[model samples]
Target: MKWKANTLSLRSLLCMPLTLIMLSTSITSAVIPVKTAYGEAAVDEQQVRTARSYQATLSDWKRWAADHAYALQTIQPESWSSNGGSIGQDKFSDLDILIPLLADKRIVYLGENSHGVAEFNLVKTRLIQYMHQTLGFNIVAFESGLGDAALGQGRIKKTATPDTMRRSIFGVWWTEEAKPLFEYMKETHKSESPLRLTGFDIQVQSPLFQNANWIPSIKLKDRALQAEQEVHKWRMSKDQSGFRKAKPELIKVYEELLQAVTKNENALKMDYPDEPHIVKLMKRALEDRIRVIQEFNELCIQSNLLTEQGDYSGAQSMMEWRDRAMASNLAWLVTEVYPEENIIVWGHNGHISKAQSLISTMPKSMGELMPKELQQESYVMGLFMGEGQAAENTREPIQLNPIIPGSMEDILAAVGQPYTFMDLRYRENERGNSWMFERMIASYQVQMPMPLELRRHFDGVLLIKQAKMPTYLPDTHK
Candidate 1:
């Protein structure tokens, strides 16, 4: 069989041994010459079935689009790069279709299989701009530290520099492809209605990094900070023994910090009688932050233990805990932080998909745990590539296998457009039932097969037929 020049022959990569990369690094480390995120769990080889052919003819697609109700006429060749370009006139205009589809939705999630793809960064950047200008989606919550994003947004108000954006989000996004979005965010601050940025993660290690004020006790905070530093040091050193030693110490100190904050609520209110409300919310935020550190550390310990016992899937299943905590934090942001505003969530497809997890026994995902209102008001669009080089932030780019037969990528590849979108929300047609409910390949990284029911997972899907190596920015500040 003839193979595409760009497609690599590494289908056996996943069949090799599995290794968890990092525990405390900002990005979740999967493992390899290239480890991946979107839950760094290992899968059984038998469970990872071969890609099947889902390719359909043009007429067949017409019927599917007619049933799904929309097949966006995407502009060919980097139409998403136009500056302030409007619909029907510019390349970015194809994105305007998203405005209507997302209308009346309270939250919108844009997901990526790999964070290191250049096209994903650029397209999502353009989407953020379009949504902000036309749809009034002023908030963009990333998968960064809650406090890190808060600090970054504050700096955006002050400088709005690209460096600040790099520091605020995960390390995976620190690339030239991702820089334009930060610049756009900077420009927004100068506008009448600035786009706001925040993180929906519980990964912030220090309470002091948050907007939270009136935190209790200097002694406890100092000790917790010191412990966190040690844990971070050990993690970065890749010294497992050091990490194991430092982790428990940090956990102990953090638990004390949580206890101290909980105990001081009454005292803080009494001390600051005039600012009771701010004190309460701020103090509660401190508790929330403490819980984040506690939960992450606990998950790491459990994962390490499970790995030692050879329970690889169970070790990965621990991500369900992390995602649940993140969902709770995101829900808090919606309820208490931006109750009236429309929210745009940037995260991994694994976290954003409303469908059950195909890798984990727990099955539920962050989208499933999102606010109950999200069932009716949320739209998630997953991103994928047919074939080309895909990069992970921590490693060099890898050549993805050519579009596998019977995969969602194969069906999407048949669309003929270099760039295209398919709305999965509508399923009014009875024809083409196999591709509808059939599980198909939608790998997280390196062409690894992890199939799922197409329509059940995403409201829509955006496909970039090829990926290029992302131009990496300098190492991040954090």
Candidate 2:
């Protein structure tokens, strides 16, 4: 029940002095009165200093935006100018608005709850639009693995196969930026595109609807399943005999779930402060998850060396489950696994931040993972949506005609012309649509190029706050 990490304890020790000073001098303290806010007449000086420092960072972005508003407008949607009959590249100095925040590329860290944060949603939409339109990137690999397959693929011309993904609905309310991207694809590349979506996250199977798993594989797996079925029947059946028979299977699930939850609990407690009661229930649900994994692994293990593709029945499942099993250590893997001039991953903010999630065990900052050469070779940036700007007020979203490497010229061409958006805060039926607001916020552009020390692994960070600023063109070249 006591949630604490030794590392966190160490961090507190290092920050305590500054924290104390910040607490004493914080504006909040003065405005609220020391006694009223802290129940003390005097506050620690370090607390005040720490609070002030945090306040500055929290608003640093907005401050930066306001200071460069004129420059920002200049880097609008139609800012690019063509040199007649020659290489048409936009000037970089004129369009510094698209630089990303968080220059450290090593962490490739994004921190935000996936279920919320429209800002994250906007970023994703912009990235998808950019990659597909400009770079000719035709593949979209999702963390949701197999379940993502249900979403569909983008289009590709001259071929019966489609390369686009289906219109997705989950996690949309919070990830409002995603709506525009899908809508754009639907409208533009309704028939042709090659940006196929593939999810290696989990095997696709259904229990209620009867997926291939209708028949269990191994004897143990079958027993485990039979026991489950028996329990289900007992729960629904009109006989007491079945109830007694189902108890064992239910107990088995309870046992497995408890173990898994305990393992996860011990892992989560170091940072998250939620109650322990949830751990008990989490364990019970984990049984089904464990069974799915077990079956998938078994299938993989039992297959012959030259097994047919169809033999892999339970390989695809839920996106989250598959991602958890297959996703490598991100920082290490990004740097060492894929060998490309530049690799960009589109994921929720949570996966991209240094803060904890499904990936890391420690607070691994981006600076630590970046290789020196990459810092010299690439311009790393993260694209995030601004807090209140809309995509239109920002600019028209368009795919970079050719996904050119990150350069001052490319940035210039992308910034093209200035655009305007009206404030809809007072409008009807508007406030509930966070996606719209996210698209609006995604309008403002902040580019954070990877710092010299942390730029090797990536080129730059581009964050899109408003979803619509980037033109939503379908992958028409399928």
Candidate 3:
């Protein structure tokens, strides 16, 4: 590779794994070694996937664009940079920048994948830097609510103890890799911290006290069964001919009870002290389902992504479970909202997808969740991996099966159709192999296609790439 020759430094040559050197002879050269954000050793091109022939040709990309009814020529790449350079060529995969679709009108949501922890953190760190410096975005919301609040408070002043700091600010669920970014924000931004972090997990945890599983499913079922029994009792007490006379009154009672439960934050606190917000929200969520019973099950099936033991039925059950929680959170955000501008959501790839994403489980899209005017002004971008060439191993054998060009049907047959490609890293295949496996190879696994419906809804798309390495923002202009 061009980068390997005359680029490898003495320090890097001494530091690179002996195994990698033996696997790729071209990598043994002299150049200055660049360290990662977390001070990890820099990786060379050999570590990335070997470049592959475009599986779907540029024509195929255009056709897929046409299939989606998008104006291919109209969807131009937006201008963006680390300092002021285009992505690829000299920057590391983790340091690439994404051009914003909404410019200042909306935020660019960067996703963090759970499977690849290190890669997730690297990209996250660079993204934080870019958003803060270039975009001047202020809020950094995580898959958490309470944690964000804690971080916000902590930033104002150090109220948390050392050991308790991370827990209070990010919650127990977050991985260690994600915390450094917050710390960096706190230190760099200080009282004027541009990167504010928050978490919904914390607020939910506060109410539940124990794990959500400890809520006792049987007890919940009993409550539902009791509500049904009451209804039956009311029906039996009235005469058949007079049923219509009492029907309105009986129905009114049930509706009133549901509303009361949903609004009674104090009642929720009595039952689940730690999770009053979750309980109150859940009540409202349940009412929503009861109002739309038939469609309820279908919505659930579409919202769930990963499951331990679930088919469509299981997905529905999971959705129903999550829907209530999501609704409750939404209610809180509605009533007790903060800044409307520059809010960044950090979550897993599945949750960020416009199609059946984690956020989709909510009553509305993240953009829709905002106030109507905010909805028009706000935008969302799901950061995803590209099949470009960042995921190759030198020791492995290369396989090449370029995708059949101009065939969305074939691409989806190999992968799935109605998909939107989100290549945040612009990684291509190194082994040059491409036969549609049911799942993606780990190297090229970060592909999350936007659904056809969602792609059309966006003002524009800002695909990120890391083709270049160790270069500044201005390099892209060259």
- Give the best candidate by lDDT: 1
* Ranking, TM-score, top scorer first: 1, 3, 2
Q: For residues 1-478, write the lDDT of model 1, one tens digit per residue.
A: 1111222233334233222232543544333332467656555333223453434343465445434333435322232223332222244455645644675677999998887788888878877766776667878999876656665665564553665766578778877887777776766555555677877776643334222233465666567566656544442342445555655566677566556656776754553332223333444444554564445555565566667778766456557776887788788878787888888999988788886665545447888888777666888888887788878667477888787765677666666667668766644334453465565567644466676777778888888887876888777344
- The root-mean-square deviation over C-alpha atoms between each candidate and the true structure, in angstroms, is 16.9, 19.9, 20.5
What TM-score quantifies how close candidate 1 is to the native fold?
Answer: 0.72
The 0-to-1 C-alpha lDDT of every candidate, in the order given, reads 0.64, 0.32, 0.37
Spell out the clash pairs found in candidate 1: 31-35, 52-405, 52-406, 53-405, 53-406, 54-406
CA lDDT for candidate 1: 0.64
Predict model 3's lDDT versus the native. Answer: 0.37
Candidate 2 per-residue C-alpha lDDT over 280-373 given as tens digits, one digit per residue, 9 for 90 to 100: 3223223433444344333333332223445433332222233444343222334443333133444443233321221222223332233545
Candidate 1, which ten residues in sequence have the lowest lDDT sum?
A: 1-10
Q: What is the lDDT of residue 238 in candidate 3?
A: 19
* Per-residue lDDT of model 3, residues 1-478, tens digit only: 1112322232234322211122535644444467778785745534334443464343344443333321111111222233322223233322222332323344445553223333344445655555554445555656554422432333233432232233333332233444445445545433333354544332222211122232334544344445444433432231333434544544454465465555564544454332224443444434443432223333332433223244455454544444344434533543454445465656543444333333233222333333455444444544333222221212122222333333222333333322233321222222211221112222112332322332322322322222111111111112
Candidate 2 contains a number of clashing pairs equal to 111
